[model samples]
Target: MADYLGMLKGEQLVSLSENFDYVTATADFVGLKLFPAVKTDNMKLAIAQLTKGGKIPVMALVHALDTEARIGDRPNYETMNVELMLIKEKLNQGEAIRKLIRDTGMKETESEILKAVFNDANNLISRVLTRVEGM
Candidate 1:
């Protein structure tokens, strides 16, 4: 069985991969040509986190994106949410996540931080809690 970053059972990961195969594949195909480094870094973080935990780093990515959106000209909230959801789904699949990250070309430390951010569900929840508390 593929290690899938050592995060999930092979069967589970495969099922998740199948569920979002089309989007993931297309994203990868486009990402390779259009936004190589960025896509690669995101996927790498996703897979590494999954290997260490069993899920994607959804919350962190969402938070990061939210911050980015806020700093820039924000788009419609729902649209951004949808985009993030697709990204989250892509991150859940080991192979897809691996390919995305590999194609992006992120540094080791950036990958490490992403993996650490999503090391476990609780960690993600805690981050949310902290952010909420601050707000």
Candidate 2:
């Protein structure tokens, strides 16, 4: 479990809880790669809450490619893949949702959250199949 938390200068990670649930539950939309990063945590938390209810939801937002530029006004910035992978790994490991947040780097604020409903449904199918086979 490598620590994926990056160096923080000033409150790096942002949460997107309310907006995410509103968009997903109401509009049934998934996020794209280049959507705004604002409220990312809120989005993540909302999905985690759904999982608690036995529903594995999928999030469609991509790691922002321009975070560094916005952070430091510098060019040649790295995207947030490493952090995303770390979060994904945590999900796989059954770590609490809050633990994942404690370990990642800063996320985007304005990223649009696409609908994860389809992806989530597909994942559920595979998981159920695996369990059925094991039985």
Candidate 3:
């Protein structure tokens, strides 16, 4: 398996843990191009070095996107707000939620619930990102 370095918005850098096939699947699921570069022998060290000066990790950013999709209730969203805020700069929260819905292969009738989820996730992500940016 080959490891590749992926960058989002030029600031967020992710280390692809899988080979080409799995990387493609992950990128499609996340709706991000994730431009790949040369592989690093020690990704953790590379990430730490790259993110020096208080920068966040790419894995943490990916977790934020995943969190938005899994947040089912107000309490969950509230609890995970800090984690989500870290990746606000890396992705468009609304778009990421919508892409997740579209990628789920759901039927039209079920879209109502999906739309609601998308809206909720979008609102939560937007609010948290805004708050984090202002801080």
Which candidate number would show the highest TM-score if scored against the true structure? 3
lDDT by residue for model 2 over 25-60, one digit each (tens)? 323222322332343543222121222323444344
Off by over 4 Å in 3: 1-109
Q: Model 1, residue 132: displacement in angstroms?
A: 0.5
TM-score of each: 0.18, 0.18, 0.21
Per-residue lDDT of 104 in model 3? 60
**How do the candidates rank by TM-score, highest first?**
3, 1, 2
* Candidate number with the higher TM-score (2 or 3): 3
User: Which segments of candidate 1 are over 4 A away from where they belong?
Assistant: 1-7, 10-119
Local accuracy of candidate 3 as per-residue lDDT tens digits, 1-135: 001111111221221112124342333222223333344454232111222323433232235543564432221111111221133433333555445445663455344533443344445555544454455
Where does candidate 1 clash, by residue pair?
5-51, 7-51, 40-101, 40-104, 44-101
lDDT per residue as tens, model 1, 82-106: 1222212112435655554456543
The model with the greatest lDDT is: 1
- Kindly provide the TM-score of model 1 when superposed on the true structure, using C-alpha atoms: 0.18
The parts of candidate 2 lying over 4 Å away from their true place are 1-112
lDDT of 1: 0.39
Ranking by lDDT: 1, 3, 2
